[model samples]
Target chain A: MTTSREIRLRSRPQGLPAAANFELATVELAAPGPGEVQVRNTWMTVDPYMRGRMNDVKSYVPPFQLGRPLEGGAIGEVIASNDPSLKPGDLVQSNFGWREAFNAPASSVQKLNTHGLPTEAFLGVAGMPGLTAYAGLLRVAALKPGDVVFVSGAAGAVGSLVCQIAKLKGHKVIASAGGAEKARFLKDEIGVDAVIDYKATGDSAAALTAALAEAAPEGIDVYFDNVGGGHLEAALNAARPYARFAICGMISMYNAEAPVPGPANMALIIGKNLRLEGFIVSNHWDMMGDFLKELGAWHAKGQLKWRQTVREGIASAPDAFIGLFTGANMGKMLVKLA
Target chain B: MTTSREIRLRSRPQGLPAAANFELATVELAAPGPGEVQVRNTWMTVDPYMRGRMNDVKSYVPPFQLGRPLEGGAIGEVIASNDPSLKPGDLVQSNFGWREAFNAPASSVQKLNTHGLPTEAFLGVAGMPGLTAYAGLLRVAALKPGDVVFVSGAAGAVGSLVCQIAKLKGHKVIASAGGAEKARFLKDEIGVDAVIDYKATGDSAAALTAALAEAAPEGIDVYFDNVGGGHLEAALNAARPYARFAICGMISMYNAEAPVPGPANMALIIGKNLRLEGFIVSNHWDMMGDFLKELGAWHAKGQLKWRQTVREGIASAPDAFIGLFTGANMGKMLVKLA
Candidate 1:
């Protein structure tokens, strides 16, 4: 038997969760049962969507069960396995909980297929984030060559992938990040056509319009929205006639208990024939093979890149998750278990 | 010398329009110039969009030229032609003004390819309204077989075709009309799977939800929205996990000077991964040839049926146009001119 540290949901959070909501407890792990694999957690993702799992409300996904350990995307090393598909020394990714070590049915875990890329990339560019950007932008938004693409929350996990994927798709990509550093990286490093530092921009509407003019000139064809609320309203105003908006994640208003309010310019849609679609990565698993192939090719071609914000220990997962809303991460935020 | 009686915009109106906003002027008509054709208007369509042009506001289609004859969809007999492509006595459809006679380039009129259908059908079933329903429901909604299709303002032209097309496409159609009679017509005559009388139901939300359930045990797949405002919110609440909403018009709140309030459920969109698209039939002209072929085939197959709310005189165009918001017409509203 091995001792494991498990993080359990102590209470349902109201909004921004406090540390009091999570309880760190020690549990004894049993030997791997038939068809089961035991994994030592290596790296786990902390995302804005975690806040939704903390609430009891119904969403596209089922609410996280109370008193249960919250599970998300994670990368780990299988210590031992009774299942023939997985064995010792295999690095894997699983929908595992916030724990140091745990045994799961072999069916529940997949051998992380990094395919020569960094194993941790499974939790970021080659994983859910990759598929979300690929399907939402290309399929839903119908992103085309010379199409102008704008991404909100440009420094976050999914948003960063969206900007990179847009560029790879041969579209003009514009990104908005919190500060000058992230904006510079978006433009100079990532090769995004334009970048807006929202912190430096006093008026978001003016800044957004000016950026659209400078980058798009012709007009925006697709908008990948991660930050909603007022930012979404602003995009609506600046959106070109016949523009398409892909609603991937609304991190800005996810934690609000009350109904979010803003300018109601829905009439613009009628005048412009705009197509706005809301989407989740879960609905797009079928596109993974296509996504991974293209993403890998783009990365190899130097047409795509991604960044990760890493933290040490399970105790830092909550902080990393919360800091996502404050625009702290450069790209995907991961909890690294040493 | 020929004299023609025409309706001209006398002045712009704010809020509810009065009779003083229009003038009946008689003008001497010139003979058709080279490459010109003169059409004697026989049937004119009055649409809610006309009201939007009374005020100086930007719209998808250009605002009505101020102090000029108000133009809309119409069908007429060609009285004179000087162009090589046209001859006299040919029936045609024109985006010509509300007038007795006018000369325009031969390119302005398309020979009404009604395939022996009624000339007035050019303004209704065989024209823009039919294309509006066809393209909006099939192309934008991307409706599939057995999908549960819901249409608001089902008694009107585009909405009526939507119901018929949905039914033809093997969908269970639930339609919403303003009164019990039209609701019954939607069910019994149009053969929609279900109907909701918004006026009698009082609580449109509950009525819509119940109607949706009665028609769609599998849940709603597509919503062709014409009413907008509270109805849009109701549709959002009643939408399935991945429902598609096609915004054809917004008659409910179009006349309001200030934006209508309540039904703030856009958060449902992101939560449900919904797709909402807005389009006008004019932009999809490329699809017209195939659309007319199919629509004519359906009509011959008795799978298509349409009603026209034809006003007897050109002088009654204003009332017929105003009646759209009040739900006075059973189908396409048209004006017959001598």
Candidate 2:
């Protein structure tokens, strides 16, 4: 028997989850059965969507059950395998996270080709968040060449990729980040046309409107929304005629105790003929091949870049997740377990 | 020369428009010049969208110019013609309303066939409103056969037609109306599968949610939003996965003195994978030919029916328009001038 440390949901959260809501316990793992493999996790992701799963609500994804190990995107190395497809020492990706080691059916995990790239890229740029930015812009928003695009949460995992991709696609890109450091990173590293430090302004809507007018005088054709509430309202105010908004995530309202108000100017949608569509990347798995090919090419050409705020060891997983609500991370927030 | 009584917009309204905002004056009209025709107005349409044009803000249609005759859909007969394209007694439709008689270029008007149907049908069923219902449902919403559809303001011009068209296409439709009379019209005349009397319920969202659950327990596939605010919130809550919303108009908040709140549950758009698109019928003029052909067939087969609230004379046009905000009209509201 092998001992593995795992984080389990002790109870459903009321508002923002506390450290007590998660219980870290050591579990004895059984040997791999037929068609199964034992994986020692290397890295695990903590995303905003995971917050919604902590509550007992019917949503796109099932709620994380009580007293069970939390599930998310993770990259691990196969330790023991009874399946023909995967062997010991092979690297793989699976939806088995918040645990140091796990035994899952081999069919449930995807074998990874590192291709000399960091294995952790599968959790950030080449993984779920990256694919989200790709499918949302290309398919949902129907972004065109020369289109002016605005992205909120511009320094986060998904928004960072979206800004880079929009720039590479021959479109003018405007981004909004929280702090000075994030704004500087977006401007200096990603090379966005404009970066609005949303934290500096007292009135978010007015600030965004002024920033957008200066960056895109003709108004934005596409708005990729990662943070909803004020960001959504600001985007609506700055949208051009027939603008498209791809609603990826709304990180701002994830910890709200009560129902928050929506944009006051939603009626502008009728006058401007705007289209707002919400999507999940998992639903568009068919686009994975194209996304990987293009992303790989961009990375090789030195046009793509990424960052991470990683916490070491399985014990730090809860703190990492709680930090996402406070905008503590510059890029993807992950926990490394070796 | 002849005298024509015209109603002009004297000034923009602060909130809801009043009769003082318009000026009715008699103007001397000149004889038909080269390529022009003198038309005596017969029927003029007063629609909900006209309210938006009363504000000095930029919108889908340009704001009605101050100190000028307000323009809208009108049907008139040519009393005299100078162009070869039109002659005396020819019935034509033009965007020259709020006037008893006017002289316009013959090229500016569309000669109507009528085809044993009333000439006023060109202003309601065969005109912009009908085409709006067709393109919004078939094209914008991408309506599929056997899909369940929910229509707000179901007894009005566009919503009533949408119900019949959805029914004709083998889809189940649930309708919402403001009163018992309008509900009866929707059920008895339009033959909608279910009807919700929105006014009778104290809480709009709860009432709509309960009504929708009872009517379409599987959840609505398409939502045609004529009334925004709470209705939109209820629709968002009752929508199934991958649902579509064709936002044609939002009559509820048109006369608000202050900025009204939007749907609080818009985040459900993400979990449900919903697509909310706003459209202007003018942008879809390309679908006119197909719209007329299909609508004409339905009317001839007795599969279509319509109602109108007619107020006599151009002087009653202001009252007719104001009545729309109070839900005073059952279907198309019009002013008969001849």
Candidate 3:
């Protein structure tokens, strides 16, 4: 018998999630059934979109069930294998529940070899969020050379890659972060052309205008929308003709008890011929291999950099997860089990 | 010299345009300057988009310069021609301004020879607004067989054709109009599967839900947005996964001083994988001939239906234009200059 800890939703969180929303409990795991592999979870990824899953509303992804281990993208080592695809001690990634150990079928997990890359990167750089940023920027936004990319929520796991990928593709990358320090990391570390501390600006229109004029003197070609509302509106205004905006997340408008105000300048879209698309990462998994290969080379060359505000224990996962809206993390927010 | 009566924008209106903003100017025109043709304007289009032109703001097209003749799409008979491509008494379409007689270059006007089609059809179903609906529906929304389309301001110019075109493409069309008369026209003449009267319902969300249930029992595949606001929100709610929306116009928010309250449920976009696009007709002129051919065939076969609120005299152009937002037109609104 193996002892494993699991975090379950105590109650649905209203607005911003709190410590009261999550509760951890110990579980005893039984031996793996036929075609099942037991995973010893090592790393768990926290993302802004996961907050939406806490609500029991119909969305693209199903909502987290009450009293169930909160499920998300996780990385672990297969300690026991009943499936031939995996052997004991092989690392894997899956949409596994928030458990220290769990027996899942081979169908759920993707085996990870690392191939001289960081082990934790399977949940960050080459993970779902990473591929999301990659496919969205390349496929959805169709980022071209010399195109200007304005990424909202720039410090987060997805937006961070969006900015970096745009930069690597020869685009002038401009990003918005909630704090000055995070904005600094975006400009200094990631080589984003411009970073606006939206918190300091207090006005998205002004921030986007000033930042866009500096970053994209020619015009904005691609707007990778991670945060919606005012940022989306400002982008709409600054967008050149035939611009593409990939609506990845609306974290800005999420958790609002009332209707969020629409960006007043939406009328600009028709005249400007804007393409605004809203999509889910799960829909674009076919592009994953290409993304991993290219991103790995970039990582090995030090052309790509990743940041993590790691919560030391699974116990602190709730705070790190909730801190997303307030901009507590620099890059990807993750939890390490001790 | 041809004596021309013209409707000129004397001043920019503040909110709802009044008759006072326009002045009837009579200008004596000199003969065509070598390559020019003197056009006697017959039918002038009164469209909601003209409202945006009334404001001296940066729009898709330049604003109507104050004290200058307001220019728009019109089909006219060439009273006199000096160009090789055209002859006297030929029917042509051009942006010849809102004037009874104007001297325009031969390059500006395209001769429309009844070609077994009604001459007025050039100003309505086969012209800018009509081609706009076609391009936007097919090119942007990508409406396919069995797609469910919802058009707001459905009895109006662009929205009416959008509903018909979507239906012609084997789609279920749901329309929302301002009054009972417009609603009846949408169902009876427009052949939309369902109709919602905005005036009677008084609530966008409820009316849309009811109309959506009736017309799009399957789900909303495309949103033809002519009326923006809660209607956009309503369409967003009724959208299926990978649904497309063409933001052609936003009559609901045009006069709004502030941002319209949004669907607050926009986070649903991430879950649904929706595509909301904004387009212009000028960018899609290459498909004009094909559209005109198909629409003419549909008309000849009696499969296509149309109606127009012909406001007699050039002086009524401003009033007729403003009546668009008020749902004063049954189908296309054309200002007749006699």
State which candidate has the highest DockQ. 2
List model 1 lDDT by residue over A1-338, tens digit each: 97888677889876667778887778899999999999999888877777887887777777877677778888899998999999899988888858888999998988776788987788888888878878888887888777788888887778888887777667788787888879887888788888877787743454666665666676677888887755566677677888899988777677776755433567667778898898888887988888888877877777767899898998787777778877778988888975
The residue-by-residue lDDT of candidate 2 on A15-76, one tens digit each, is: 78789999999999999999999999999999999999998999988999999999999999
lDDT of 1 by residue, B66-131 (tens): 679998888888888899888888888888858878889999888876687888877777788888
The alpha-carbon lDDT assigned to residue B320 of candidate 3 equals 86
lDDT of 1: 0.80
Model 3 lDDT per residue over B19-127, tens place? 8999999999998989999889888887778888888787768888989998888888888888988888898888875889888789988888777766666777767
Clashing pairs in 3: A60-B271
Pick the lDDT winner: 2
Interface RMSD of 2: 1.0
For every candidate, give the share of true A-B contacts it also has.
Answer: 0.54, 0.80, 0.75
Clashes in model 1: which pairs?
A: none
- TM-score of each predicted structure versus truth: 0.91, 0.98, 0.96
What stretches of model 1 exceed 4 Å from their correct place? A58-60, A168-170, A200-217, A261-263, A297-304, B13-18, B55-59, B81-88, B202-217, B259-263, B297-304
Docking class of 1: acceptable
Best by TM-score: 2
Expressed as tens digits, the lDDT of each residue in B87-176 for candidate 2 is 999999999988999999999998988878898888888888899999999999999876799999888889989998998998899999
